[model samples]
Target: MTDKRTTAPALLCDVMIQIKQRLRPLESQEVLWDQAAGRVLAQAITAPVSLPSFPRAAMDGFAVRSSDLEAASPEQPCQLQVRGVAYPARPWPGTVSVGTAVRIMTGAAIPEGADTVAMLEDSEVSADGQFVSFRRPSPPGRHVIAVGEDVRAGQVVLPAGRVLRPQDVALLVALGLTSCPVVRQPRVMLLVSGSELVPPGVIPKVGEIVDSNTPLLQALIPRDGGQVVEVLRVPDDPVLLRQAFRQALTKDIDVVLVSGGSSTGDEDFCPCVLAEMGELVAQGLAIRPAAPTGFGWLNRAGTLLPVVLLPGNPVACLVAYELLAGRIIRHLAGRSLDLPHCQRTAPLRESWSSPPGRLEWVRVCIEQNQAVPLRQRGASSISSLVAADGFFLVPEEVTLYPAGTIVTVYLFDTLSGQQF
Candidate 1:
């Protein structure tokens, strides 16, 4: 009996909505402050104690009552007796009396009865080390950072669902937090299958191609906040693929990505094996370069696991991941439902063309504020992805966009030598 499982390609927006509705979020876990970088915060953080927590000198200077230096100048300086030195680690010995000053270093606590600071450049010390003369007048509270000025106690330092960056971690450390509650990284498994595929660093024997999808997906998954737990290779046999899928689902796998066997060829048995073992949600998408992509759900160990089938072509695989897998990964990590890349609009230097009824992702490079389409070399060319700055989308309704049309460019990097 012939199988009748082929379904029409689903709209891109509909597929995304379905994914958002079906996938469940992962749980939160405690992580050290250092390990929390790039992880989303599970709870809001309030400052336990104020930064600095004390009034300190902002620079190397002498602390004194401002009224005493009212008549001070370069030609006629005000002289005061030297009291004591105030180092950051050691407090001043006594309060400043009238006509007396204390020598203080930067960040040292200001002493009692001192209302102003006269910088070292504007003050002269006597040879006997007994007196200091101020050449310029200083206002009360000048050069002094008041307590809680940087961060007040009980202030909200970080909000929930924020992705922690290096600066964010530093701020948490400054606020005296040794650890943070962050959403746990999702566990992912990668399965690459093909009979004519060989491992990287090995010379392919004439008709074999080196497995690039494994490394590609490995880097992409972790970069998007999913931890890769296992990567395995299987031959063009349905039994091996089915066994591997079931084994992974029985473990603590949150998602499974299968590459290179999603199409309907004689050896392309991924869709069939997955259909026999689980429920297929999507058979295809109306998307250029990655129409053979598919998604499904498997029940194992009393939990549902999402398995996405990516195209064999390198570029198509990357595109499919960005479209579907990225959303699920971000959701599992408690990140916002938005692409992490910085987006901008640029005019097209040349007109773009695509067949109607499919969403197309056109690789483009930014040159002189113009988006220039990269040379089309089909979906297997990895070099095109490397040379591209980002991609511009062509909606399914339109077939052509004229030159000089401003289009949104979803950047892969900031192009400012920084990753988003």
Candidate 2:
């Protein structure tokens, strides 16, 4: 398991160079308050004013200054004249000369002269409105709020490259900010090439099947944080494919994905077309079911737009995209490397065989804690992938397994919510 292989479609130079090169950063723009949730912040966000502006009451109890309640104890008593309840920004009754108290409601501003106001539960009131007694002594600075405690004015609350969460939106609103800056979504262009492929609704004359890759790809593009600006399909000809690539680059696409015509067959003109677009770093890999995967770039107009030529098989194409092309897309979108790939350890139900010097990913279903290998591992058929929850890798160095051995499974579907 510790051994490694350097079987990429391109040279190490191209791969490393492209990863180091920083593509165009997303645009900076403002969005409405309600719509700013889950967007990246393009600029540093600072607080215009201190949070709470004033020492607002966090509870419904009375507001107090620390000095007045220094010696209040349970055994001793204190009394003050009953002042009426105070409202927000209202005038105080007057200064406290000696042994005087004010009745304050929750969130009311403290009077100018009053140093502290004790809670009603802590003191007993007299019918004469002049006596109050505390059974227990109270502490100073207790139950008091200070200004600028939560956040200070001009303080940077959120930094740039910060992706705003739902709570972030609320915090920005609390700071009196109306809009926020965010990056622009990445744009993608798709090209599907093959003469044997026909549209689904078209009645084929002979030797033709409906093209399923177009609809499948169109549906998956937007979910990966890239917008599908356009999806084009053309017959199996180099002229058409080359023309499509040039036309797509003119429209300013961040990445271009061309499906089919990537194999080693004579009709496979995608590699030639790819060489013309950008220099081919590598043309083949050591992986099974996708050995013919090609990598290149469109270096026209100083835009080194990476092009991923996926195999024609639907399952192979998708899995390859998820494993390889998915990484490039994440790089473009400024996302982390940790994709939602699931991992699990399941018992092998039975033994299996694979070709030598090749890594095989076998689809399996978890049935009663056993990894049941699907009967058919077809490269072209997409139906086999529908019921699979994960795949167990048969390493090139490994070709045999006992029934009960523990094998790590790279899950396709989530193995969540299990009682075990």
Candidate 3:
């Protein structure tokens, strides 16, 4: 266990890899383009047809040859016909050739004979319906959208691994994509096991704490694009634990997370349950506040469900999510959790210490451009994280940092409105 302190992040990272290897990137399904934003693409999507499949009008004006406008300025005017030149749709073939022009609206298909567009502002309609006049020369392709200008027919408009945004949805719609291929959201089962835990809103009769991990994990999992298929808060009863675990697995769930009961505490039944069910892949990571995090495989009737066991402490839970579950989620979503690309520099506003073994995840806030440590340090400080702005990692070699030391603050949440 002591050796794990130095090797914890790596060991936890290995557990992340192990679970990721067992789980599959979600399957693909068709979702309406308008509703597809924030969903991951299952496969590479190429344009079904050339965007602007036909040369189309980009403005509500007359389609005319550029040469007509070349000579005509505000002083000089060019006259064209309304009937044969432009119509609501493409006029007859050879309708507006060379000197001729057609009236078109925005998004209307360009006529076969028209090569340019003359804006209405640059032109005026005569007293008669057959006559149109423009004061300026229209350039070639003016106000005209060229075929395939937006997306080529065979082009990979969006490659795989694209997280659909609102703008992407609009583009897909413009390309006539009613439904898009999106990776299926994995169903996650979050099970919190503790005998000393009470449900929320329950009056605490001394020594009883509400089980915050259940709700926190339930919310966190779905935020990563996975569906929380089940949430169970069973006491330390082994029978109830097994029953709840089985129930969570009974429904289709991709991942199973048993919260708390990982340490060598008196009522820790999670390890015993793992032994009775299947193989324990790894147990007891060597890290502060989250040292008891565990991971293993649970076989129920020969079906293996990758299980991630995190410590009961709220901070430990967060760290487990970052180093373990978060990586798996990012990987499954076709992303990488590499060394975060960020400035990583902030001034420490407070002092903290950890033994020279585990990397300390110190929560701090940036005040007046300074990184200030939060009020909590031990594993049980639940309220301390709420007051902090961001966190920084103290390498295993470090013991403590005095205030005013310049350190790299690796932000996990939205500190300074940054994603890093």
Candidate 4:
């Protein structure tokens, strides 16, 4: 029996909306503070105690009463006795009196009755080591870090749904938290099917080639916050493909990725298998280089798992994964569904043309503040992606971009050698 399917491709925006409506972030779990980086916070964190919970010296100076130095200047320096010294974790035993100053180091606690700190450079110590003189008067609270200056108690330092950074881990450690509650990473199962494909390090016969999609997806899955739990290689045979799909669904996984057999060729069986086993929400996309991408929901016991079908062509597989599968994985991992790239506006170096009614992603390299389109633009050309620095999209209604037109380029990596 022939499988019936929709001929018209679904709009990219509409398919994304459907995915957002169906997928929710996974449950939360506790992880050590060191492992919390790059994980989304599932709960808000409040400061239990204020940062720098004590009044401390901001620099190496003497703590003094502001009134003692108010009328003192270079001509008439104020002479005060040096009572004691204060070091980090060691506070002066006595308070600062009306005519005495305490020698303090940076980050040391200020003594009681002292409201100002005079820098060592601006003060002179007597040869007898019994007295210190201030040449300039300092105002009250000068060079002093007051209580709760950096963060106050009961303040929310981190909120839910926030993706933690390396600096964030430091903040949590400073807050005295050993562990943090974060959304669990999504688990993924990959099924790569192609009879003409061979594994890496294997010599293929005349009609076969190495399977690149499996390794590509394996690397990409974790980069997008999902963990690859299993990988299954299936041939073009329908029974084996169905068995692999069934086996993947039975395992504990949040999403399934089928890397080949998504197009309309005679050997293409992903769309048909998915339709027979579950509901195919979208069979094709109205986007260039990845129009054969498909999305669906599979029922595992009582849970519905999201599954994506990526094209067999290397470039198309990458495009479809970044635009569709990546978003789904990020959503389940409690991360933003937006594209993970830095965008910059630049003028086109040459005129570019595209067919109307389909959105196209054009790869280009930034040259002297201009977006220069690459020459290798085929779906199977993986070298184009490597040679290009970034890409810009042409909207469905627009057909042509004239030379020197300002366009936004989404960088594959950051412009300043930083990762987004």
Top-lDDT structure, candidate number: 4
lDDT of 2 by residue, 174-226 (tens): 88898887766568787888888888789876888777777777766655556
Write the residue-wise lDDT of candidate 1 on 1-420 in tens digits. 124357898787887787778776788899998799999899999999998788899999999999999999999999999998999999797999899999999999999999888999998899999999989899998999988999999999899999899999999999889999988899998888899889899999999999998888888887788999988899999889989887887777799999888887788888888888998878788888889888888888657888899998999999989887877888888876676678989999999988899999889899988999997748899999999999988999999999999999999884466432
lDDT of 3 by residue, 239-301 (tens): 887787678657787777788887666677776677567777666775666878777777766
The TM-score values for the models, in the order shown, are: 0.93, 0.75, 0.84, 0.95
Superposition error at 71 for model 3 (Å):
3.9
Measured with C-alpha atoms, the lDDT of residue 228 in candidate 3 is 78
In terms of lDDT, the poorest run of 10 residues in model 4 is: 411-420
How much is 312 displaced in model 4, in angstroms?
1.0
Better of 1 and 4 by lDDT: 4
Candidate 3 TM-score, C-alpha based: 0.84
Off by over 4 Å in 2: 1-35, 41-49, 73-138, 144-162, 196-211, 342-376, 390-420
Model 1, backbone clash pairs (residues 3+ apart or across chains), number: 0
Candidate 4 C-alpha RMSD relative to the actual structure: 2.0
Total residue pair clashes for candidate 2? 7
lDDT of 4 by residue, 291-335 (tens): 999999899887889999999999899989988999999999999
Question: Number of backbone collisions per candidate, in order?
Answer: 0, 7, 8, 0
Q: Which residues of candidate 3, in runs, are more than 4 Å off?
A: 1-10, 20-23, 73-76, 84-94, 97-99, 124-130, 246-249, 301-303, 332-335, 338-345, 350-353, 397-420
The lDDT ranking, best first, is 4, 1, 3, 2
